[model samples]
Target: MIDEQIFLSEQTQDIYPSRYSNSPHMIPRADPVVYGSDFSNAPIHRELIEQYQQQGFLVLDNVFSDDEVLMFQQELNRLSQDDALKQCDEVITEKNSGDVRSVFRIHELSPVFSQLASDFRTMELARFLLGDQVYIHQSRLNYKPGYRGREFYWHSDFETWHVEDGMPRMRALSMSITLTENFYHNGPLMLIPGSHHTFVSCVGETPAEHYRQSLKRQEYGVPDDRSLEQLIDEGGIVSAIGKPGSLIIFDCNVMHGSNGNITPFPRSNVFMVYNAMSNKVAEPFCSQKPRPEYICSRKNIRTL
Candidate 1:
């Protein structure tokens, strides 16, 4: 069966001009997700690169061993339970249940996570895909406690990043390494395959300090049902499910989100955002101020 393409316009902009300040139009993605043409020295094979390019995401199970998963799990427990980190501004609690929802700038918080960020498996793959020396634009630990964790509405990361953080182009990607088994019922991350080809400019005006609420539950910057449906009709949604050591790497503009976990199994993952050093952040396109450093790192670009 052939895959269907919708709204594949001939127009290609130099940059992905996004949905901002009630913008109604959807910009077909012009930027290439995988910039590295020569993968001779890269870890992944040619077929894998094609698969990732065709679909918006790549799922690799057992990317880490049980021992490494255990180490990550222990580190997860420590950081989530740390009195200092729990009280820090970097920590984000669930809106309703008051449970810990996310912890940002975690690579700066713990050496274990920092080490994982620099791990060749994760780092080199990013370098290969981004086609340049990369740095962490952002890193965080996401935990969705069972029964109380809330759903993250469907949206594109680059939409938020570009409008808020001044990310100049769709030249970044996120790699999420699972620290816990992502069961189907545990609110695993979901992506619309092949949906990265378009940029759905959102409808609402971004409020100041939106990150304060967006981390727990994003309200604005979400795609309208019509735009989301159009993309989903062309490329169906798939959950990134796997064992504790699995890795899911996806484009920065891919449409993704997760449901709230009601089952007893809690889901958690370590997320790292890699940006090409040449594509550093600038002034915001829509917002009056850039997001806090923890959410969008403007400095401390590391090569790994």
Candidate 2:
């Protein structure tokens, strides 16, 4: 096993320097259950802080205006059709129809995306969860096209980042803002409410392969049929069904996945990862070097 303490120290010091002196375990998992009814109305309230800290996830409605979301929708559609943009690896295409599957690194690609990253509402909530100076770790727009969108395998993001990107611990969170209505029938994201508390180490050398295999076989890192039986029996899965402009904040270690969109309705959303500057990534464990800054950002500039 790796000397987790020293490894953690090295990770934190990679950029911020001396911010972390102890083991990664020094950061404990949040409580499992918290808050009461009527919490969503005032999510910024301190009481609800525990709600997210405990369940490892929180869903908020109407974070963006409908007009803003429509503008973004139009922008993404336009970009999807641009041949110049299509040539970029950031724009992934579907295997069968050749339609766009996802667009990565949009924080630098669009002004609206950059503005969203620095938005006060997003920044305030991110700071509450990730500390005062959080940086954008990754950003992507997932377009689950009607009837052809693929399934994302069940897995904790932190697992991949930890081993592949050299992140020492789960001091990060993801905020997914919906650009289209996410009905249950449209392959909305599914989460095991408290799964973030447990780390699942399914065998996989790279997340890309794990995802490719998962979409093809439904057997990638997602809990196996047997394991699913136990995890669901314990925590139960929750479908993230919401309208356009709905925003969800989730822990990086949360066990989550979504089904393939076989229905006619398309589901698209933008998700950005906010990583604490104190949790900077160290040297890679599985690769000879770290991924490019576009994928795994190294900039320590505070977005908020």
Candidate 3:
């Protein structure tokens, strides 16, 4: 059941309405970009905070050392070789090649990922930005294998989370750690500088069991060309390219996506989402059955 508080409260109902599934709509963002004000416990400084506020995304290089990257990389290789993981429903494979595309609930799949999720640098930044205790809304390892890798179409994550997972607001953020160097030619993540300020009500109804297909190539909840053009025209596009161990922090509602990685260099990264504890998920606003536990955790919610 949808939380009564979320349905009736002022915070969830009309402030950031989306899906339009019936009729599309667009509105300026209602939520603040920088949710937390106090920086005493913040791992980053004021300039970075302001940058996050103004641009809606920030990239930091050398967040993890080479040794750490190597360890995680090896772990990923191990997970890839484990035939059991390959057959699990949590694993999504590429469209054509059948190579692994993504593995969800990574923290639960391996202790190495568990440690990375709770690492001071990533978690502290999430807490500092959210101004409250936080928890992992979702965790995954995204892979764009060398040639024939697929593209993740442009879309706001909150759009899907709100409609499918029952998240009420945009008090969430994403931490993407680069395990392999993200080169400009190898389908790096791209984002509009200030597009997070716009709420794009995507045109599409939530199909039953959509996550099965959406994880590989998202079709629904995707913004239209007209809407995307307006955003790109205003904020412009920037490719987040960096060496291994780079970290990307972006607003939950930011407009971003990546292209197909046909280059010989494959792109892989660790993705963790942190949501403010105050904004716990309830019943999905779209009325679909809640996504599986691996995708969005509602029961036994734990503060990180």
Candidate 4:
């Protein structure tokens, strides 16, 4: 059940000031938007803010250093091999080969992951997209292994959250930081630009199935073939192919998906979902069982 205190309380606006922007929503995009220790200047931050609002997504290059990426990769690999991780509900594996597909709420379990979630640059950008006091609602590591990675169907994250988790609005966004090269052939994320303007509600006969497992759904709560075809024809899909340390921030309501990885190269990314503290979820509205807090967070503590 959703916490009543969180749902009814008024939101606070105690945001920390940063060199990036005077206001949370005014991030500029510099003439040459390159991410680094000193790339969050006024112009680039403002541009980034505008681009995210207009297009429902923004991709920035070189957000993290190569060494940082290597460190994260090594840690994630260790976690994948850890036998204890198999017992946790947070880990989701491929049905056939048992390869790890995703590990959720990593921040809650690991100190380094928690620090990464609270990273100043990431939190500041998340505040710009969400609000001043944003909460780390969900964090996960997604892995698309070579040759056998699965496909994610076209569905909005907010749709699942709103219906199943009882989130009231679309005041959340996700940051995907690439740990490996997101190549064109390695199941890079595909998005329909400007698709957040419409909410594609879906209904099917099977309600007994779990919602978090998008791949295992017998009947998915996603757009039908005709609707999907029309949406793709009009909006056009974009593949976010980039080197390691690339970052993509996307609106939760955007229609997005990815194909199965057929190439030998593997794709991996760290995904963090930040939610406006004021936009807390209510009681479960559409599902018999609410997913565990590890998958859908109930805490609303401000990250910054």
Judging by lDDT against the true structure, name the best candidate: 3
| lDDT, candidate 2, 155-218, per-residue tens | 6777656655677667888999999999989889999877777655554334443333332344
lDDT (Cα atoms) of all candidates against the true structure:
0.86, 0.71, 0.87, 0.72
User: Which residue pairs clash in candidate 3?
Assistant: none
lDDT of 4 at 47: 62
For each candidate in turn, give its C-alpha RMSD to the true structure in angstroms: 5.9, 6.7, 2.9, 9.6
Candidate 4 on 97-188: residue-level lDDT in tens?
Answer: 98888888887777778888888768877665564478887899887788877777887787677666766667888999999998888889
Superposed Cα deviation of residue 257, candidate 3 (Å)? 0.6
Candidate 2, after superposition: displacement of residue 240 in Å?
0.7
True-vs-predicted CA distance for residue 295, candidate 4, Å? 0.5
> How many collisions per candidate?
1, 1, 0, 11
lDDT of candidate 3 over 47-138, digit per residue (tens): 99999998889999998999999998998888888898898977888777788878888987889999998999999899889888999999
Q: Which has the greatest TM-score?
A: 3
Tens digits of per-residue lDDT, candidate 1, 208-272, equal 89889888778888888999999899999899998889999999999999988888888888999
Q: lDDT, candidate 1, residue 81? A: 86
Quote the lDDT for 110 in model 2. Answer: 87
Ranking by TM-score: 3, 1, 4, 2
On lDDT, the stronger of 3 and 4 is 3
